[model samples]
Target: MKTCFIVCPIGNEGSETRKNSDTVLKHIIQPVCQELHFQVIRVDQIYGTDRIDNTIYEHLKTADLIIADMSEYNPNAFYEIGYRHALGKPLIPIMKEGTDIPFDLASLRTITYATDNLDKASAAKERLAETINSFDFSIEQNEKENEPVHQNITPYLLKIQDEIEDLKGIMLKRNDEFAKQTVELAIEQIQKNTAAPENKFAEILMKEIANDPKKFKEFDAIFKNLS
Candidate 1:
């Protein structure tokens, strides 16, 4: 079964914030997820000896769906939401009605709920269900490819890498050409200044280069790795 990871604030137990979270989980999220056959997992439900933060990160990356509650302006929740967005995965952002969404995330379609009113809670649940149902979660479909990171930043980074590779190749070729020309010029100058037999100095220098290939290889390597 597909998993839906919940990213939300978990205030201290028995506090009003905690009670609101419980109601949303029990009434707003779990019911709809259950009907859709999604296995819902939350940070509080996680159990094991593993570091909790690491475990939460793994879920944020690998979960098939994510429902991030923006209520309370919780820093942790917002950070996780940012992390999830960077992965270009499915994310459903929700918040309590009247809560102001940050400007950066104002463009996202966030489901607003009012747990104090039964009718609004019911409506929010329906909206959440509809949003979940609208996603094309088939094995062959990737509905979350439209995330901003994937749409813009990933391609930009890849393009930069490609350009860097191309530049390295050009620099290496130019370095090799320059080295060859410099050696040829030096050989020409030596032969002219020394009164050696015609082309004799060139032949001796070429023979020395052939015999000590490692020296030329080291020289080339130094240039290759420059910057």
Candidate 2:
């Protein structure tokens, strides 16, 4: 199933920031994403022992789509948005009306709504759904035109580029599966009543390694050697 990673400002519980974010999630983002069959993953909703930053990066790399809330000029939200942009992935940026978006993203398309106004929020949700719908249309268009053409060398290079992207996606999915299995096994061991303190430390170490691709690769190599 396709996933939509949400990059938004999640403040302390009961705070105004959290309340506003929750309102947007419940009233706007979640419903639209669900209708489109996109499994939404929010940072706060993620449980378990994984390092949050690493998990964010993993999702940023792999999620089929991204929805970013630009309210409050939140640095973390913008940072994640930037990271997704850097990856050259699709991201839908949304904001509350009157929120000052940073100069860099000022020119990008942003869906704005008034949190306190029902009509405006509903309209925003419609626009958001349309934007996401376009993604499916674009993918279909790409697929239709994916036939090899004998036109020029440029087409050949483009083919190579597409192949590279496909390979990268496959590698990312496999890595996620491997990481998930490793984490599950480690959790099972850690939950054992007789597990030692050293096992607890190992669990922490595993979480760190799982977060960093380079570290994870090194760990994988060592594990293979031991096996």
Candidate 3:
């Protein structure tokens, strides 16, 4: 099935932007996507401790289209949208009227609407759906035409690199200390666990560590000690 990734806020319901986005997703976006033969996947639904980032990354990589609500400039939403941009996927950027888009994305096309009016929101949804269905909306073509002259690293990759770099720094900082010995043990355990043939839990834990630098470092000593 053709899939579309929809990015919006999750836990915070007090924000007007979040409420309007929820309405658009439930009342308009979902139905229109269904009619257009597209499966709508929301970011908020994919939560938990195990493989969440990996799952979300896989979805973004494979989705036919992405609809990002930048009204609140949510961090996760921004990260997902940026990843889509790097993957050269078809993306529909929407925001509440009067909000200024970041300068970096100002050149890209975006749809803005006033959320207070139900009519405006509905019209915006219809227009967005129509835009997605149009034959001229080719993500591959757009990416090729606007391709950067130099190689640009994706935010996802950059994040992973940053985490690895942080780990390296932590190792250096702990060198010649008792903490170093502790970290060495944790790494040994992690390697064994990751090397195991059927340790899905261990794999999940590794991915979680890869995603969060602070958490990974705090427990790095303990994890390394494991066998």
Candidate 4:
């Protein structure tokens, strides 16, 4: 069966936002997916494993379809969505009305609803169901053929790690123990930050560093949260 991965911030216990998220899953997304024969997958639904683990990359890469909730402006959701977009797959962006849609993604279609308004939620659900029914998967499958399929996520991340090390090596020489920083410690911090408690900016910043090691100003900007 096809899988529909729900990418949203799992709220703390008893939080109103989480309660609202559960409502969307139960009344809006779940029923629609059930009728469409898609197995609904959510981070909270995973049992006996660290929910905040890097395995989220697996869901982003492999899910047949993805629905990302933009409410609360969750950074991890956006980060995971970025990888999904890079994979060239089908994604449905949804949000509660009044939530900010980032300018970069403003051009794409999105479903918006007033989470507190039952009528609006119901209408949004109906439209989303139709959208799911009419979705075209052929384009996504064609793109997926060009992307490498990884059975293990570690090796794929190791490639990123190598890039990180290469970037750090250059930085280390320029400031040999500048501020008493070492490449090993820097990588350890990056990996630890990326893995747990879900600090999305660190993950993105690390990727930016790996992508362009020579850009000191760029790293400075990320450090200052300027970009």
Q: Which candidate should be chosen as best, given lDDT against the real structure?
A: 1
Candidate 1 local accuracy as lDDT?
A: 0.74
Ranking by lDDT: 1, 2, 4, 3
Looking at model 4, which ten-residue stretch has the lowest summed lDDT? 149-158
What would the TM-scores of all predictions be? 0.62, 0.59, 0.54, 0.59
The collision pairs in model 2 are: none
117-207 in candidate 2: lDDT tens per residue?
9898888888788677655423421212234212122222222333334334544566755544544454445446345424653675577
Once fitted onto the true fold, the runs of candidate 4 whose alpha carbons sit more than 4 angstroms away are 48-52, 138-227
Best by TM-score: 1
lDDT string for model 3 (1-227, tens) is 67888876665777765577777788767877898888898766767676778888877777777888888778988898888878666677777778888887764556666657878777777767756764333434333445622222232222233334445467566553433443444455444644432243345457656776565676665447542
What overall lDDT, based on C-alpha atoms, would model 3 receive against the true structure? 0.64
RMSD of each: 21.8, 22.1, 18.6, 16.5
On a 0 to 100 scale, what is the lDDT of residue 130 in model 3?
59
Residue 182 error, candidate 3, Å: 74
Candidate 2: stretches off by over 4 Å: 137-227
Q: Residue 30 error for model 4, in Å?
A: 0.6
Better of 1 and 3 by TM-score: 1
Better of 1 and 4 by TM-score: 1
